[model samples]
Target: MNTVTPVRFDNVNVGDALPALDLPPLSRLTLALYCGASGDHNPIHVDLDFAKEAGMPDVFAHGMLSMAWLGRALTDWVPQSALRDFNVRFAAITHVGESIRCTGTVTEKFEHDGERLVRVSLATTNEAGVQKLLGEAVLSLP
Candidate 1:
């Protein structure tokens, strides 16, 4: 099994970027599964006809699913307990069959309430490098 070396607070510094992670390519089945699991069965995410009627070329992925993938990338890098806050804004729609890459750069670091914390600028991009999500996160480190 692959093991992750925990990131130590002392070893991390402002401007240190976490390695980029690429999620599996999004497919129609993936969208359908997300709709089922999240209970966000919005037709826009699973119905091509509904989406086209809504002026979109085809059904697209839910923004929350991309956000969840971003969260997955973060938690994979550091233990979930290290996450203090994470928020994102949907920048663009992610279409099916597109691969997404999640990346983050540490923007700042400080000690608060005896805890060493870091702020990171996070983003997800499509294979063509189009930004899909934009946001920031705060993490508590050990």
Candidate 2:
């Protein structure tokens, strides 16, 4: 059963936290598949030898892959139509076999131009609590 806890605009408040999204531990196959799907084809993400040649200890997950995870978490919480703007910056490299958790906190809620709006601060962190992605998103509510 797919259970979705609906987020209603009227009940939202500043500082409200969104339900978190947990992803399975990342893997080499996952990174390779993501590379194929995203057309990134960056050797640094999928080729261990290339990554080592680049001075990295191992191949790393693409920043956008983690960003996509964060976006999926947000849209899963509320309807995608409610999303007005979303942006993120990569904070640290996410490597294979790391667990990622996507989380968000409502930062502001207000009415603008007769539209209900909420701003959320978002983050993706690994098992060690190292932040891999820092981001913000704006939602327009009905």
Candidate 3:
């Protein structure tokens, strides 16, 4: 396996692309694992049959899992950077087994109160380039 290293950015700037990340399909087991880790036990996430009966084709991936990739991309690129803020709104449901590509670009950078911060505009897309329009994230880095 190739070793992953953090990219050292001297003074954050605009137009920088965060490293790309690929996530596997969503599954009942995956949701269970996420629930164990995050302490979110919303039945809609793990109960597949219930989900199907509720009009969803299958158990959907956790919104956080999709957004977690975005956070990982940032930390992967800036290993030492501290994340000050992160947020994402679920725009669409991502079914299991879909390939999600996490990506981001630096939208702005500036110093606030003596702390350097970089604002990144983040998004995720599927192999076919469908984002599910799932969500957008802004990460503040120091």
Candidate 4:
């Protein structure tokens, strides 16, 4: 498991960056467990043979699994009280043996129609520092 950020915020606004998250190398068992827990049965994520057949050298973690890590980071920073929208884009595949790091920086905070929205820039990368995915989130503040 990764350590959650200790940074706390009240009435967080745009242009604020959440603390970065770093985790140890991903374990095969962890990937298996995630597959079961998330109900994602893609063979490419579990069986290396199937992965090779699918043009990959070995099995990799699900894209959504990585996204879940990103979500965890966000939820930790914002808690459940002020968040109303969360979304991400999958940009590349992550193999089971690699470690992943999550990060995000707030980019915008504004209001329209009596609603307040905070836009954030986010991303994930491998241990080698290669960005595997990129995305953004619109957080509705309470």
For each candidate, the alpha-carbon lDDT, in order, equals 0.90, 0.90, 0.70, 0.78
Put down candidate 1 lDDT per residue, 1-142, tens digits, no spaces. Answer: 1127788878887788887889878999999999999999899999989998999999999999999988887887788888989999999999998999999998998889998998999999999999999999999987
Candidate 1 error regions (>4 Å): 1-3
What value does the lDDT take at residue 86 in candidate 1?
98
Error of 3 at 21 (Å): 0.9
Model 3, 1-142: lDDT tens digits are 2226433336556897766887776556778898789888877788877887888877887788777777777667665336766766677777777888888888777677666677777778878887654333444443
TM-score list, all predictions: 0.94, 0.93, 0.80, 0.84
The regions of model 2 sitting more than 4 angstroms off are 1-5
Distance from true location, Cα of 113 in model 4, Å: 3.1
Clashing pairs in 2: none
Off by over 4 Å in 3: 1-12, 133-142
Model 1 CA lDDT for position 43: 99
lDDT of 2: 0.90
Better of 2 and 4 by lDDT: 2
